[model samples]
Target: MIDLPIDLLITNKNKDKTVDLILSFLSKENYPAIQKITDSLMYEASGRAFIKIQTGCNKFCSYCLIPYLRGRSQSVPVSQVVRQIKTAQKQSVKEVVLTGIDISQYQDGKAILTDLLKQVLTETSVERIRLGSVYPEVFTKDFLDLYSQNVVSNVKNGRLCRHFHISLQSACDQTLKRMNRHYTIKQFKKTVAQVKKAIPGVSITTDVIVGFPGETDQDFMESLQNIQEIGFSKIHVFPYSNRPGTLAGQKEKKWGEVFKKTKLARAKKLRDLSKQLEENFRKQFINQTLGVLIEAKNKQGEWVGWSDNYIKFQISNPNLKRNQIFKICLS
Candidate 1:
């Protein structure tokens, strides 16, 4: 097997030359993409599987190089996606996460993300499906409808997991504007509120950049305040770093250095708040039962898996085995 990084496989222009060299060495044709492979491969020993439905990014967020490095957003055909899921089901895979660099932009011909989801639900017998990080604007009527009709209504059946990890890089409007994010804080709030209303007990998580180019003290404060108000169950914190070709990277050179210590301090504060928010969100589900897909045992020798709401659960039951779905009560 080739050991090339995923980025090289996806973005390298000289892939033909690389493959020719490999073929000369090994006397075999090289298949660059996994989807191109026409043979049955061993599924993961774990119950869960991650299927890449889309890749690359089109948003061109100022802080990101995904567009330059990964190229434009491209989606796997819906037929291919369905076939993969069906294969996974036949292989006894219990759960599948429709993953991508930016799955929010998934489109295949006339079919959008919602349409793909509908097809997967109807055509495949996969027990659980989850999504990768999504843009705030992805909450269109059709997307919400799929959740309401297929997901929320089938909570008992565990068809789709009710957790969303939104790509909210910065909560401050000014910082977000500088980052070239399409949606405003107001729009994000509205979308989030709508999601909460539609699916009660849905877990909302997000990514936050602690320090961005040209972010003032006031901007940081605004972001922190808004984050608290939004009450995200978990936060993935990133302290801004310069990438060679990114607009934010060039802007950072002109904007002068934000103290490394200062960035760490901000990150620490946000992380502490995340712990509190997560605790609070989990507290609400205390004494409640959730359908958890048993993945495997943790390092501590306890059975570990994730609930439908994306909360991690650890149990020490000796009778439990892998690939089993059980309704577990939170203590």
Candidate 2:
């Protein structure tokens, strides 16, 4: 019922500094402006879409580009977002991820995240709905309670798999402070524990940066200890990529080269640990069947998919098509 032009932003080309000035203040919430641009582009391509409801972050994680690139926190109205979801459904998007620069930061005064979820799932026609990143601080009791139950409370082949990608950048409290990460290890641990206890069998993943401007050996050890304690299914480790306009960059410019080298080394170490973590996590899947959504066609005519819990699955049968739901028995 809403008229808007959804445009795709181009991220290619050879150092096109001329266009950089224009992109600095682009707001994703301006849907009519977006649709104007997308309406033209869709004439050539099929529409597989993204609904980014939350816009920006207030937690200025030192090594991140989200706050500056996306700006401060703004959430799309539930009515408007549901309208977009209905539109995407008409176009045959089998699943949709509710994304944002910082979805956790979205709170329209009394209208909170749980309210938005109730509105979306209850009213909309999205076949499958997935959430974007959620912050550690706001992983409240209400979120866990509503999302805990699978469609039929069927433990084995459950529905409505609500996963969380929590940000626990460094398990070490000291390193977290140096990186200007707001939450502490104890607080983060307690929050995570409570969430897991609330939502059993929920897939939890995280992000960790091994080396920062002021991380020490003891700090790295502490991080590893916490990672071991959490037993996270997966982790994306970035060796602290520094960007300008952040406080850390300003303070550590003189030690840039040295810091970068240390970061590289620490990154390698963390990566090794991450692989071990994955292998350990995989052991839990030794004899389990998972509901997977096939999303890719691999070489040799195989179909690949991701489980609702976010595990990768591969099948060699060419008969299966992309975006089809399948039950995968993992080894």
Best by TM-score: 1
Superposition error at 280 for model 1 (Å): 0.8
List where candidate 1 sits over 4 angstroms from the true fold: 1-43, 152-158
Candidate 1 residue-wise lDDT, 1-331, digit = tens: 7885543242243354675655654654454532431222235677877787887788999888988777898888899889988888887898888888888899999898899999999898888888888988788988887787667324555487788999898999888988999989999999999998877788999999987877778888889999999889999999988888888888896765577888999999999999999999999889988888888898999999888788889999998888988888999
Quote the RMSD, in angstroms, for model 1.
4.7
State which candidate has the highest lDDT.
1
Q: TM-score of every model? A: 0.89, 0.81
- The ten-residue window of minimal lDDT in model 1 covers 33-42
Q: How many steric clashes between backbone atoms does each model show?
A: 0, 8
Q: Please identify model 2 stretches exceeding 4 Å from their true place.
A: 1-49, 150-159, 253-258
Q: After superposition, how far is residue 308 of candidate 2 from its true place, in Å?
A: 0.5
